[model samples]
Target: MMSRPLATALRDATLLGAALLDVFVHVTSDEPLRMAVALAAASLLLLRRRLPLLTFLLTLPSVLLSDAIFASLAALYTLATITRRRTLLAVCAMAYTLSDMTRWTPSPHLDLWNPSALITLGYTAATAAAPVFLGQLVQARRDLSLRLTEISQARDHERRLSAQAVLAEERAQLAREMHDVVSHQVSLIAVRAGALQVATQDAEAKQAAATIRRLSVQTLNELRHMVNVLRGSHNRPTELTPQPSLTDLRRLIDTSGIDTELTTDLPGDLPPTLQRAVYRTIQEALTNVRKHAPGATADVRACFEGDTVRVTISNTAPTRPALPLPSAHYGLIALHQRAALLGGTVTCGPTPDGGYRLRLELPVKQEP
Candidate 1:
């Protein structure tokens, strides 16, 4: 039945309603035709729910003229469910007004004050209002879904950014550690080579010279490793060698010059990242002292207080600045940044006792 054109069923019922009311009103009293008209009206009524406005117009003439006013009620229901609320309301109101005005012509007078009339008016208003309400409900749900999706996407992006930041920091810390490990060893080699240069009085010194050369080569290899650590260019994860911790500062002291006084309460076996930072801080401070305080005695102190590893380097200040400062001592600036990244700090200045004082402190770990 759905395959048939909707318009056909509506026309049949309208014609039938008109014929039934006409005969009843003494307009056409053919008994056989009246029965057929009533059947056609039933057909249009059934299909009216599928196409409200069309069925209403088709059945309107007969309903308005005779006892068939009841036909419009079903059509109004369909309009409320399927069409826009404004259109449904306007159509229903107009149908009511036209049907009522026909009372001036020989039609049945509709008493607006009657309960039946009020019921019909209420039904029409509900039909129009329902569509607007449902549309609003559906729209609200869609907006909520969109907001949830946006929040989810933002959270995922935030996680990714945090992971990248952590990875970058780890790479930098590894670099600083490798540089300290390699630099300390290199300074020792240079010092030993100077001593060997003075003690040799025979050809046997040639062996000592060779040993020094070997040490220099070992130091060069460490420098290369330090560079690779900073660049972090390895594709394989295992290619990145692990570094020593702050516990290894004893190695640093062993190679260091006279007047070295080590005092550290720093955490033992600290997080690799924080330990690497502390190692670099000491390396830079000592390097600066050796270069700037030539012929002047100094003392080195490293202390661990709670969450921080503090390194202080103090040396008698010279009347003149060091002859060579190696490009404004970029090492000190690098050390400052390393400590800051770890949530620590660094300070370098002239001591009240006329000595250079350097101190650095950095955090133990990233915040959870």
Candidate 2:
């Protein structure tokens, strides 16, 4: 593509060449004074962009002295396109018309009432007005193009806002469904478990009912958090419930139902993220035993080895026939991802004795 400066330079050179040609055709070399003025007018065309009014005034001498008027016309057009003062443009047009019509002689006379003189005056005025009108037309075109670009940008912005509005509405609907249907069902389950715990006479049955009530309440709390998140409550800070950590491990094992043992030498002051990762890994391991290895016993071990924390969970093979259950099967994958985030590693596989063993190792001090 041609660069703007190069294009503009080429255009100015072309206009100057045309002005030179006009001077060559009308102003003869024998009339040295008139020829000099015409040449000066043509050369002054170079300053039209920056000094249009001055260039036009200098070129007027050529229009009055000789028939070379191209430089004057180009200057007037440049001034008209750049300036919005219509009165100034009209005055300049009138000046050019008078200069073009009057002869170079000091005592030049015009018979104002003569039909030919009036017609000549009108023709000169129309010629001067042509450049002004063309320049204004070009200016209007530029303004219109700019206005159209602004309008297009505004429409695109409106479309984006409308799309966001639709997405927000969908999220609100999902939140309402979870609160109205899912929460209500979980609330009923918790109430029934509480009632069962109170009414049951068998100690084992009462303990089971208590565990069920506790788990249902926890699930409800989690559901409420999810609904709030979905509802897009950004006006105020939302306080999420406390996340699980090493401190909650004992309660989790007690409520897990499967026979499990937990042994840990992890410090109480460990970073909350590390504690949560360890807690979740043990929890998932025990849950898998209860679901896929019914009647299996699980052993969870966690200890600080120098600058690293090592954790392992092992479960014996199922004593009874494993029941088919719905699973997303992402538990092991999730554990590995969690460990990786903490600059750690997780490994799990079946043992020779028909058992499963999962191990996680994490650095005690996290890298920034």
Candidate 3:
């Protein structure tokens, strides 16, 4: 079935054709004029959309040669439809409206004072003025709605652009953190271990060298994870990967290059964020312990109180003076910020009992 708009246009075209054909049959006194009227009337529908203003202007010639009521009205509506130039339409409507109005005349039958004449006059004025005013109102509303829709689409596009820009900025920032924290620390561990492998003739030094190499690999693995997280695109769960958790504290203790012991009162299931935090805190403290307090015994204790988790790492006094990692240690700071982002606090200091100590406290988010 034809849609409503197409069906309506077809009906109007047929009616316009009939009305113009009737007037054409009455008006032409000769074959030549008759042929022209038939061509113009039939062509009006086809030309109305293609040449709206031209169609309206062409109908003026018909007003003198023809008296087709519906054809003239259709031309008026066409003028209103594709009207880019409103001034011409306004002028034509005004001229016709005024012409249709009555003026007082000498003959009583033809005078504007006649009630029948007045009604016909009013009808003409209304015909001309009503279509013009209604057309203008409809056109104004259409133009306004079109402008509003365009503005709304532009705002939506801007929001998408803004979101993309912010994501790019975040990825760049995270990349910098990974390079600064994870890369530098891992590189130092590799270099130090390599140096120790060549220099130390003692079995103790050889063992520490092996531990450093293991820690360096662990650092590189964690760094890869950090990079993946920054990308924020993956089908697999991040938790599936080896995450340095409080459970991993024992592993870190083994790398401390000292006698190590651990006691845990941690929950069986830990939130990934808090677990990761506890892991890094232990890792950083042990890295420091390996660098400063070589051969010193260390104790690791982790306990959860209510919905909060904490880790305490304390090592015997430095055999040599305690030093920060040879290169920049970005992991500690990144860990600090990570803990803070997850509503937690991190503290590192020297123990009163001649030992280096670090502590981390993180709030747990329980599944409801």
Which predicted model would earn the best TM-score?
A: 2
| Best-performing candidate as measured by lDDT | 2
Q: Mind giving the per-residue lDDT tens digits that candidate 1 earns over 104-213?
A: 35445556698977777676556434544554455566677889999999999999878867876786777666667766677678677767767777666756565665
Q: What is the TM-score of each predicted model, taking all chains together?
A: 0.42, 0.60, 0.47
Off by over 4 Å in 2: 1-6, 28-55, 192-219, 229-368
Model 3 compared with the native: what TM-score? 0.47
User: Model 2 RMSD to the real structure?
Assistant: 6.7
Error of 2 at 261 (Å): 13
Q: What residue pairs clash in candidate 2, if any at all?
A: none
On TM-score, the stronger of 1 and 3 is 3
| Local accuracy of candidate 2 as per-residue lDDT tens digits, 1-368 | 99999999999999999999999999888999999999999999899989888988888999988998998999999999888999999999999988988867879877779999899999999999999999999999989998999999999999987887887788789889999999999999999999999999999999999989999999999999988887765334566768888889999988899889999989998889899999999988888888889989999999998889999999998999888998999998999999999999999999999999999999988558
**How many clashes does the backbone of model 1 have?**
3
The worst-scoring run of ten residues by lDDT in candidate 1 lies at 33-42
Candidate 3 lDDT at 133 equals 68
